[model samples]
Target: MTVYKTYTIGVTITGAANGIGPILQNNLGDDLFIPAITTGLTSFTFSTPVLDGAAYSVTQRIRAKAPSQDCSSITPVSGTVNGADVTVSITCVLSTVVPKFAFVTNSAADTVSAFNIDGVSGNLTAATPTPTTASGAVPSAVFVDPTGQFAYVTNKDANSVTVYGINPDSGVLTVIDADGATADFQPSIATGYAPMSIAVHPSGKFAYVANELNLAGGNSISAYSINITSGALTAIDADGATDGNQASIATGVEPYAITIDPLGKFAYVANYASYNVSAYTIDQITGALTPVADSPFAAGSNTHSIVIDPTGKYAYAANGGGDISAYSIGGAGALTQIVCANGVLTTCSGSNYVAGSAPRSIAVDPYTGLYAYVANSGGGVSAFGIDPATGALSAIDADAATPGDNLTIAAGSVPISINVDPSGQFVYVANLFSDNISVYSIGVGGALTPLPTLSLSTGSGPTSVTTTQ
Candidate 1:
């Protein structure tokens, strides 16, 4: 002679329409949750029940007519029934992440090509709102801010930085001035002479540009503070904002490329004619640069561009004279050469790897930093595996015959600017002579698989390419 009883679970959902009825899952399905209030139901319970003292769990798998939201959190998710019922609450919020985008600066056509990167297929399609946006004269390089709110382009002939406001929903570009309209400051924010490359800080509060030529000094770097509310650039003082000789921070001849470390603590520039690299520490709050002690570090001849690895532990300089200069970054942001017995990358001669005919730019994998990619103005892109400990590099075995000896991946005629996407999924090269872009998916073991069909068409002469964060 015994008496038995059963207990049910209640699911209370908030922040959604009251009439929104959905079945709860995970041992609590089979019953429709009407929720509380104006449905006029004070206390409603699920139909399925466990025997008194049995265990139960509630999951956030809403079965019907639910908005796209995450409901992984369920209160009182699992427990044993103690002769009483249990209730779980759920709250829904919408997602804000927009689509990914890629930008290309066309030096010949004076326009920037914009495209949407497909997340599933890793393909580039023309972005909505438009295909290309007008830029200043001879646009050399493009950089998207960390917040994905704006894009800055360096116009070599225009000697200015063009600002474009990125459309959050469509990934389109609209010239943004101080007031978000008119061409007063929207078209060009005057910088130094022949602006070549642009880089933004990790905080998205500042941006810097490399000036290849100037009368104030041989070459200089221009710094600016970004407006938070509106995507505008204001030149910072003592960095050639007003063209004062005393205010300019001079660099070696023809500073062609600039980059900031992942932590936003340091900045480095490659001077083409100087045959060296300049290092500086960034002012976190003010965004100003102070030269590191033993400032200019030696690089290979005719250094065109420099890149700091994702880990911020090493740096590589791409020289137009057909070699890559590798270095280990010191604690104070100084560079020390990684010497190797042999000059070419036939093996892991760490110091300088014999690049293709004319190496224009170099980039390393973002996450592991295990691989490096180079764009050759001579012909194609070269792939190399990075030695993790010594920052040494050797060519990827494309043919499996001449391991670490020859380059196999072919690109456009003058592939100048090369970059790996932030996710480390793909590599993009701006072909200056071919007037197009070459696309490749990073395969296993840091090899490259060219996707000619997915390749993108650009304006006349594409000098630089970059992607949104």
Candidate 2:
């Protein structure tokens, strides 16, 4: 005897109508019409047991008889059956609704571009009045805060950090005054000679800027306290005095980029001329920085960019010599080099991953924490898989080349910066020479499939790229 079980589904219709009915369908092409009720809740049962590891969708009828009439819509709230009992929730309403956005920074054009994100396809459409001008010059880096309420741009040429209030729904940018614009404070705010990179703490309470040029005493990291209410910034006092010099933490020569861990407990600066990464323990109370043990960790030549995995366990540096330096983050925020041994991370010779030509920037996929991607300034992009437990990088075959060098794919000419979207669904690369943004869809096992049709045209010298979707 083939005994079958039953699954019970309950429907709750908001704004329940008097004389309307909704239909429910299963994968087997069977429809069940649920009668309207004066009360909001009703229950229906199906006699067939659901197969394990199989997906079954129960859709609701959304048709209306007359325009603007009281027609109820149906939706699957929950549906599952187990043991001797079955339970599910099917929701219905008159109608339901929603929206999304993306942003791009153009360095040469001195502007920022906004786009509307298509939820289904992840495609971008230019927003009205596209390419908003930057308030400062040579905007080298842009950071949209975690709250998605504010944006910070570091203008290398102007030696200033520009603040902007973000539109939550439309992804628009409007400059905010950080120097006594909202509240009266001591002197106006400013950055170093060439602020090359900017990073906001996860707590949304501090912002760090890397001053890349050699000013008299200006080659340092600037610290600022964020005004959460107004989305403004105020310089932190280095000595905890109002009259003392503004907070400036000195680093190796020509620091090019900075990154803070997701935990907000540590920060790192990649020094281009110094060939090292400066590590620091963040002062949570004052936003000041203190050097960690073995302060400056040695890296390859022309260290350009640094990134920490979402797990907070490993850190990587993209060097100009076509290789990536791997490090194991210590408890006190110190970095220890991770030497690769026979495709695994171990204490061995050569503590780096050979990458594409002139690797400039790198990003770790936040979803699996198992992959890292680098943008090669010489030409294309490179991919590597991270050993989660050991923090060593294993080369992922570009197509299926087993036991080969690091996998490389032609993305664009002179790809400078690369970043993964928040959803971990797509990767964007800013090609300096090509003057366009290349879009790639992330696939299983960390493969990148280029969506050539979706390549977005940008202003000249799109040196940096970031997203706030």
Candidate 3:
């Protein structure tokens, strides 16, 4: 028999822009038979008290009669509430409107997008663009500052970083610093080589970038000191350092992905070339990194992705070689291979087994930490039930269950990445070859049920997908 634990969920909605408060009032009013409306200037009140775990939905409608320059703009909506003693808030902000990729500053396709997220319905409404002082760039990653006052973006092709001041009440963004603004701080030329990823420290004092360095002679990670007031980035110590076994902690061959652990004590990199993973201890005070003993541990062949569990107790790598590797993180930030019960390391400990096929991305459900989804370039995804105590994976249902139309036909082509929403209710896959995204509803048994497929514009080539909360 299996033992299951029950949990309660609580939700609060705030910062409703684009007439979200009125829309939410209407939706919840119909669903719960309660009248709700916007009271004071920007405040929303409920006629009936909301209870914990109660289901609700929100919708926003706005109309601007202006024909030309007399435009109208609605603010981004945000949700904040307590769930299981944890405070979680989701905000929407607007940046540039780019086509073909999963790039959207807030949900808006225009310069300004409304910020509205319904905690009950789990739906989003896109707002019109409202440009501020900030200009547009091809943004690759978005990092919100710890104080929630600002956010930064990595412009890969532009070779620059964009900074914006965040509006707390509306969750909208105004450009604080635009492109080519070098007086604020610039990344070292070497480290700025096609910057692919960015991470902000918990303290909001420092930021890190993973440079893909698509060019001939430059590839490395860079660090920057963030200006809390201006939201600018200034190059920090050892601006551009190669991943070497001696000087810098060497990842396998081509370092494509990087993530810092939850505790902010260690950082891990997935090396695409060396087909391995590198672990490093982070200097909490200085934000410098030193390789751990036995640092570049072997993973499956062509290891391209790594993610730490929410608890910071386990580290997982998705290998292009078609297998997922699980490692037990020691107290000292060292990684020890978690072997199978039979004393072997590379064997299926779970029910859903993945044969050798390029597994490109891995996403773990933050709520349970008991399941993970791996997107394979070959087509399907392998779902693994996690052993929370030992960090081992076992198959849950069966191998690669097709979600939608693919159930009768062949699988979609080359799904590159997978992301589970913060609510842990949906899982999304970015299909590189198909140029589409597949959304699935997660079942209580940790299984995936497919929903309608959403098509992306031609040549969008979405390499990554992240949801803001």
Candidate 4:
């Protein structure tokens, strides 16, 4: 059956005269142009034939010259099409600001939850329609770009990375639809099986994922070049396929997590089964990975997570054996285990702070670069004060000199992942077994005081937490 719909798209220019631009439809090409709107509003009628029950989108744009003679976006930028005749009204406003957001991945529910951080209290408020489908199975890790415009989630069960376009103002995640003109068709990009972790470079040009299960090669890491303007990812391969045809780079056994340094010069992977950290130098222009000298450096037994300091001078690894390993990073991205006399880094003369049962995630303070936190699966979080000169780790609680004084603070059951906000004032933890998130406020000397609540309820089995503010 042939279906036809007649729709009028209305464009209104509030302040400008004779605004010029194009009106775009998702499936249809740019077939109409905005006439001179000397008055406030103008309407154009078109009788388009489309398949019944098909979805389309309509948006409007206008050209202005205050900043430059470029097309400025007017909202509501896109309108929903349901194969029915409808009118879309767009008001062109000049100023709009993007807001900060925090995201958590619910592993068992296979969803992603978003929240807005309270500016003054550092509390998280659930976004309207809080949880959104993560678009893949077992969303294990999530990372937001430095530009704050896009987010990527690694799905362990589905072996794909779901790309989401972040709503600038409302702090929501929407999967990019199958519209090349408006959005991209690649909402979820294929990756190696059992992808565990994701890391975006500080330059915002590259992203890497640690695949836990070996596909064709041994356990591998996937590299991708990020599109700056659109936030789309293109796989980098030597064969030159436009799509993601790059073969995954081999890594140590059971690569659990990956991280990039602040300078964007190197990448690191923590191998759980191999008990080592793999270091690689990242090519600036091409985003290729080259192993550094003695790339798989020895770390604690069953190291699971790694994080680099903001200064790029040191790195830390959390191990399953309830210890955090310290290392001094070289200029060429080599890892040197800090000489420990008695489990201590032995520079300022301190021992490795013993954390909860199994440490899974580690986070560093971005601003001061002196504080670090780890989420221990046993039941709580471990806080530490990092020595800037010798790259040593020290517990922050009262008994600083005592060995195994992890300065542990209570959290919900099975705290699997943790993070600190940009201001360094608050900390968030994702509790897997309890399906809740614990909030804490950082105090003097990295002391954590839990907020007066049990915890924030989340979807099923919240496994990871990340924030941008």
Candidate 5:
């Protein structure tokens, strides 16, 4: 017996010129409908045919308006279409959801390259071939805050930090001055000397900079309280006192790198000249750092970078002496070197893990914390498989011959910095000498493959890279 009776789910959209939707019916499901409206008019209506007595659900597929605008479905959107045509309502409003941008620092050009990143595919769309904003002299490193609201850059020669307000819609960066002064002439905040890298606490309430040298005496960490509203920086009133710089936290000689744990409880610094790691406990409210017990823990020679895992369980340091130093995070944020012997496949082992020459930087996959990548200034990136339980690292595959055979990936000259996209689907490497960025798509079992043309053009001397997603 054939009973051909049908009804439709109608959607009326307000505040938009056109509306397109997907209306799913119980038997004949997943039909596309385009609601049409004349130009300059904001009201529209559309419907798709549905079978009689079939359950239906409707969702907005496209809302023709600014990217920031949003549309939501009203109640009665899903029901059994019995006889007559069913009508539902959709309301359009202004909603902003901007994400996925990449920032790169050019040390020689004194500018930062800004690229808009696609959330689905990690491809980059450059706003300009050249950088749009001018940073301070010798901008060595660039870091984006956790909230993706602002970007901070370190100027080695300028002895300051360049703060930029990130445009939510386009990912364009604009220099921001907290004091309402000129951004081109003066930096947003002053530091001791030669700030190497910057890291913001997990709470997003404070920020710290690793100054390689203090004008007066010992190295210091510049401490600042972050303004939640405007993304501005204000120096914290707290001081390091005896050995600290003026209103800043003090460390050993030439602090080259700094990172806060995922929990926002502890902070760590890698002192390059001192060849050790400095540990500190963060005063959550005051944004102050105090020395942890047995501070200045031993690491490989010439430590250049340090990073804590997303779980806040393990830490890794990239040493210039050609090896990675791994540690387990103690209760108070101190690092204890793990001694996992060879042959432990998944277990953690930081002991005697040799890397390529001049391993300058290291980073863990924040999304999974399952892999780590090292930026070797010698022209390739070393990939490591992180042990989940022990929080140590192991080489991905020792059997593969030559780099790019699945063991390691090749990069351009002087790959000074490396970063993983927020989605953990891609990797970005900044080649300082070659002035290019190498792109790689991560594969199964923690392997990397070239995404496309291998590398993208960058500024004069791209030194640092970071991402938002």
Candidate 6:
């Protein structure tokens, strides 16, 4: 005989404004409220119906109107009521707008703040800072291991990678390794120049870093073997053998971003200076890379970012010169550019689909592989509906609305990076010039609508945003 088991996932909602707070209270059956709207002095609680044998994780998200104020001081009180287990918490108190999981500014003197998310209460609490020695002048992109035992951060300015041991109970970080001194064992011990991005393979056996150095003959990619037990990096191939030659294999220019295929058998790099992308075949045994056949596919002018769709059938690139191009990836890693109805490049061949000046980044919605978003530095984001069969793009709703639609939102001057949450329910844009984050809700039909905007703390230049599990 086989026994059946089930688990329950719960969610709670909160707000920073008076009108929305009351509306949320009325919509949710069990809810709580703080007496005043005063900054750094508000508290609230809410509960979900008792769910027996339900296994779930709780997270708290905040929607604030102001960007500079800190929301970390608020605390939550959550526990079991009757026989039901629950939790309460507060949200991240940031001076600038932070994407759900993107790297925020952190330094030895100024550590990025942490928060405790309550699965039961739908709240967050300020967490103690994990110690570090590197100057926090640059922000660190955060990536967690598959086993949840450790976390890794790529510090841009520090030109170093930091490892942290995760607390199982609270999901907070504790510094374990500050530099590559004790990375997982491989070969080389030297660090890559100006490491800007880090991605851990889906297998949890290796990690790759994208060095954004532009100095003559200085830029390249780095590979490492992951220490399963220690969560440290062990350099693999030295002499930059697998490093994409510090230029795009196709365009022969500087590379900026890197991503591995979902199958873990291949990798792709975005060539910032070459206006193209390079593909490489990965050695399953050693995690080393070799250029794929017919690689260095022409992407677009100043191609700086690339993302493979969830299905891995198509690849998209954000052309910094002002457009987004799509390509159909052949089974052998070859790229075939998709042509528009008018027989021109589908990315920006028409007036309606023309992207704003200087498109910086692109992110796809996980739930529906048919939708994608582009962050245009000229201001606002561009929404596109992907043609599944052709890998073509058709703009949705005429560029959508700018950062501020409902009520004059102060989006940092130049919007640089845009990311969609794992759930595909929200989209966050990082504005470099304005130093703010713009939030938007994704509609059922793949359209983007604006949400409340928030500013970062003083001196925080928001760059990239990612979500953590």
Off by over 4 Å in 3: 1-118, 121-127, 130-152, 164-175, 178-190, 214-217, 238-251, 340-356, 398-413, 456-459
lDDT of each: 0.75, 0.72, 0.53, 0.72, 0.74, 0.56
- Report the C-alpha lDDT of model 2 over 118-146, residue by residue, as the tens digit: 55455667766644655577778888775
Pick by lDDT: which candidate is best?
1
- Give lDDT: candidate 5, residue 387: 83
lDDT per residue (tens digit) for residues 316-341 in model 5: 99999888888999988778997655
> Lowest summed-lDDT stretch of 10 residues in model 1?
62-71
Clashing pairs in 2: none
Candidate 6 runs further than 4 Å off? 1-137, 140-142, 146-150, 166-171, 178-190, 238-251, 342-347, 350-353, 398-411, 456-459
Which candidate do you rate higher for TM-score, 1 or 2?
1
Identify the superior model by TM-score, candidate 3 or candidate 5.
5
- Which consecutive 10 residues in model 5 have the weakest lDDT in total? 18-27
Could you arrange the candidates by TM-score from highest to lowest?
A: 1, 5, 2, 4, 6, 3
Residue pairs that clash (backbone atoms under 3 angstroms), model 4: 344-351
Model 2, stretches more than 4 Å misplaced?
1-100, 180-188, 238-246, 342-349, 399-406
lDDT of 5 at 298: 87
Between prediction 1 and prediction 3, which has the larger lDDT?
A: 1
Cand. 5 Cα-lDDT: 0.74
